[model samples]
Target: MIAIIDYGAGNLFSVKNALTYLGLPYQITNDLEEIRRADSYILPGVGAFPFAMKMLRQTNLIEEIKKQVVEKPLLGICLGMQMLFEESYEFERCSGLSLIPGKVDRWDAGGLKIPHMGWNQLSVKQPENPLLKGLQEGDSVYFVHSYMAYPKPEHLAAFCEYGVQVPALVSKGNVYGAQFHPEKSGEVGLQILRNFGGLTK
Candidate 1:
């Protein structure tokens, strides 16, 4: 079973809905004990980094998450993905979980739009990455974010170009992150979620 963390950073109904469509058993809760006992966890977010980290701290799940990711599979989606890094320059430069060595920052824009919305093709950086299993170089995924992760190239699983090399997918050991909302994307999204949901502890 999987546990979808509830940190009040975003509504996770869509994530839950996707998991249900996959027939995966999951529970949404803020209880640290439940989190500790879950087979795997999913941290889905759609808000600011500092505020989301604050909420996780308030719920007393920061240490739990830090400890949990080391032993089990943990996937962070969108803003949640940003929190898995060392820190974020989102607004005031708040520290992240440090699960991966990197920082989050806004796109350079380069005359393009701020939030690189809509569908974008993923350019596989680590083709052998298990998380990207059946996905290919040209598979399109949906994204809606103004900031992106700058993890070490070794940690980048895939990236997409949007005036800048946006971190599309990343992983380090058992921890993984998707910059786009897999629940909102189409079949490719479902495949991504299914791949995560099938992870063994």
Candidate 2:
């Protein structure tokens, strides 16, 4: 079973619904035991960084999450992806899960529209990545965010150009992140989730 973390963030329903539609078994919970017992875990979020981290702390799931991602396949979406980094400059100051070596900051483009919301193509940097196996370059994915992660080039799995080359997909060992909401990206997105679901150990 796949565990969809519920830390009081938005987009849980869509993630769950997508899994259901795909005929994939899953559970939505904040319980650490449930998280650890699951075959795989998905961290889905859409909201402020600091507040989301606060919720995780309130539920006492931070360490549990770190444990799971370090030893198992864990997928993070959007803000959930941002939370995997070491720190974020979203609001005043906030620390993340530090699962990956990077920092989250708002887009630095001078006049480009903030919260790059729309369909953008992904440029596969590491073609052999299981998450990007069947996906190709120029495949459009939906994105809706102001802040983006800045992991080193070696950690980036795929990227998308929007004024600048943004880290759209990143993975290190068993941990993976997608800046775009695959649940909202139609067929391509569903395929990505299906691919992730198939990565269970």
Once all C-alphas are superposed, what RMSD does model 1 give against the true structure? Answer: 1.0
What lDDT does the true structure give each of the candidates? Answer: 0.90, 0.90
Instruction: State how far residue 75 of model 2 sits from its true place (Å).
Output: 0.7
lDDT by residue for model 2 over 1-201, one digit each (tens)? 999988898589999999999999999998878887988888988889998988888989888777777678889999999988999999767999998899999776667888899999999999988898678789999999999999998899999988788999999999999999999999889989999989887
**TM-score for model 2?**
0.97
Candidate 2 clashes: the total is 0
Q: Which stretches of candidate 2 lie over 4 Å from their true place?
A: none
